[model samples]
Target: MSLQVTTIMLAVDDMDRSKQFYKELGASLGQDFPQFASFELAGGSALGIYPLAHAAADAGVPADGSGFRGVSFHHIVDGPEAVDKTIATAVAAGATIVRAAESAGWGGYFGYIADPDGHLWKIAAA
Candidate 1:
């Protein structure tokens, strides 16, 4: 059988803040609840927002994770211009600009942004 990751869920401390952040980035909200939310993303995938405490309980793990989680969400765009625009928009939407947009050594352009919960997103075009 084949597998697919249709939805990516991010555990956040503040639901309102996180929801607004994603909304500003053009994510259409869906299945929004007090402790959970879902956003429609490109390519038929979806982005899920959940409370950190609830997530930890669901996973049976501690909610004390800190520092780089050794994972990043990579967003592919049509071109460099799109990359820059997305990063800029994310920053303006309460996301911290982790890295400025620049040319990549692999003949591409990209940048990085961190959400309120420190979720890293790599905006790139290849």
Candidate 2:
């Protein structure tokens, strides 16, 4: 069977704020509920957000973990200019600049930004 990941769900501290953050980023909203929200992304994939407690319960785990969750999201852009532009937009849309946009040693441009709930997103261009 072919394997593919279609969505990445974030366990956020506040549902309203997380929904607002992604909404401001122009994510097409979908499947909104009191405890869950989803965004229809480009292509066929999607993004989901829910309260941390709700997510923990769904996963049968505790909601007390902190620090890095050891996962990140990536967004590809057209070029270095687009990378810079996207990062800027993310900051304006309530993301913290984790890494300023710059040329990579691998000869590409990229940057890192964290959402309001500290979900890291790596914006890059090949």
Candidate 3:
């Protein structure tokens, strides 16, 4: 069997804030509540936000601590021009540029940005 990921649920401290963050990053709203929110991402995948406590409870484990761990979501594009457009759009939508756009070591154009809640996103064209 092959593994296919359909959704990614990030455990956040605040649902409303997380929801707004993903929305600004161009995700369409799916399901939402005081405790959680889900966004429709590209390729039929989903981005979800759930409270830290609840998420940990659901996982039957303790949180690793506050602040972001090293995790990133990505937006893949087609060319150098598309990379520029993608970065511009994400910036205009309120994402903070974590790293300015540049040529990647992997022979692509790439950049990094962060949502309001500090979630990282890598926008790239290969």
Candidate 4:
């Protein structure tokens, strides 16, 4: 199969709040629908937020519980300060600062934050 990801969808508990969170990170609203909100990012791709229960139903699953899921979205920046700035912005926008910006042992600086809907985001300068 020749396929490329055209969009990344996050199952959000609140679409409006999620849209605001992404907007604070420099994304602009691209589409707004009854059950979904899409954001146009720097690149050509898009970010989608949909109600968790509705999304799960559309995907043929029961949204009765939660788990780590271990999915992380990475955002690459130009330098350590950029990483720090991004993390700070995310924090100010109501994201949970999972890891404070710092030098990584892997020859770079990085940090992590969880969006309003608990999606993990890694900001790195490498």
- On TM-score, the leading prediction is 2
Q: For residues 1-126, what per-residue lDDT tens digits would candidate 2 score against the true structure?
A: 999989988899988888888988889999999999999988889999989999999999999999888998899999999998898888988899999989999999999999999999999999
What tens digits encode model 4's per-residue C-alpha lDDT throughout 1-126?
999878998899888888888998899898899799998878789888889999899899888766677889999999998998889999999899988888889999999999987788999999
Task: Give the clash count for model 1.
Answer: 0
The candidate that achieves the highest lDDT relative to the unseen native structure: 1
| Global local distance difference test of model 2 | 0.92
Q: By summed lDDT, which 10 consecutive residues of candidate 2 come out lowest? A: 17-26
The sequence of per-residue lDDT tens digits that candidate 3 reaches over residues 55-100 is 8999999976655677788888899898788778777866789998
TM-scores for every candidate against the unseen true structure:
0.95, 0.95, 0.81, 0.94
Better of 2 and 4 by TM-score: 2
Q: Candidate 1, TM-score vs. the true structure?
A: 0.95
RMSD to the native, candidate 3?
2.2
Clashing pairs in 4: none
Tens-digit lDDT string for candidate 1 (61-91) = 9999999999999989999999988988898
Model 4 TM-score, all chains together: 0.94
